[model samples]
Target: MFLDEHTAKQQIVAFAKSIFDRGLTSGASANMSVRIENAWVMTPTNTCFGFLNAEELSVVGLDGTLLKGLPPSKEFRLHKAMYDQRPNDRCIIHLHSTYATALSCISATDNSNVVPTFTPYLTMRLGPIAMVPYFAPGDDALAESVGKVAAKHAGIIMANHGPIVSAETVESCVYGMEELEESCKLALLLKNENANTLTAEQINFLLNKFKK
Candidate 1:
């Protein structure tokens, strides 16, 4: 069932608190959003998720105009960019989680897929995670870069930033973000250990079967 606007606000606050409480994100370093009808409800700019006020969440038009509540997060463009490109995506969760942020800072010649295929759940939830080059916080270019890959990928790690994941529901988006962070942690743990990763064929089979 679709959540009403009021319930959606409460759900956003609840999920935000959960994210902060579980250490999925800390401080005011993350943003979240859910599309409702023609507008989007989002976390306010610079507000700590742990202490979010349900009434203070921002509601904005698809064109980015602020309609109610506090001002939208500075990363609003980032969220809008993804939504503009992918009609199927309804919720977005952006977090500066510990391990995922660490992986984002790694210098890589090939910045294609940062998270290796270490688990079936990761593959099913996040697909091929892409990497976008660094752009200063609030830069529109960051949004543009994300838009380029958002259609094909369910999640992406911004260079020197962190990850942003979009899914059909807020719950699924949070789950995908968690899967991404865990996969990144696993990748770091297995570094230089010659860990066996899923083969392309195996990954393809999982992708075909799950169709996340």
Candidate 2:
């Protein structure tokens, strides 16, 4: 599918509006983007979700030039690196929903910290969530660091930061992000109880059934 500049602008505005209505983020805590042909359409820096207009979205060339709108978000490297590697990724969402951000602030890979196999839908959407080491926000090093496993992850938790999801569409990306947050919420709720935990056998079955 060819993504025209006009459509890219609309998707950027619409995606921001949808997530804003869902209360996924507030202030300037999140950014959304889409790959349009070889370039990308992204939300501009310091913009509020509630007030985004199509004209305000930024057009960034694949080679990293700011082609239109206000300057892009500080998380430019994070978005660019994903599109540079994942040819099919059309939408990207980086959000800081309350519980997800809290969990990320304290997550370590040693936690066996996969987002859990608690829900079939979540499992199917975000296959494996990677845990990336902490870097100062908007740091180029953060984006390059994630390049190590870009071939495997759909959503990755930025240690002490938040979550980033890339998918074939905006809705799918949003759903995966929500699932990531929900999984974290579910884990907290069941941390004290041994109930509903996935058995090794069940996980093995799922692993076999959901091979991407």
lDDT of 2 by residue, 86-167 (tens): 7777888898887677778775545334566676765577676777888998888999977666657777888888888888
The candidate that wins on lDDT is 1
Minimal lDDT window, size 10, model 1: 107-116
| Cα RMSD (angstroms) for every candidate in the order listed | 1.2, 1.9
lDDT for each residue of candidate 1 in 170-200, tens digit (9 for 90 to 100): 8899899999999999989998898899999
TM-score of each: 0.97, 0.91
Error of 2 at 154 (Å): 0.2
Q: For candidate 2, give the lDDT.
A: 0.79
What's model 1's overall lDDT? Answer: 0.90
lDDT of candidates 1 onward, in order? 0.90, 0.79
In angstroms, how far off is 197's CA in candidate 1? 0.1
Model 1 lDDT at residue 155: 88
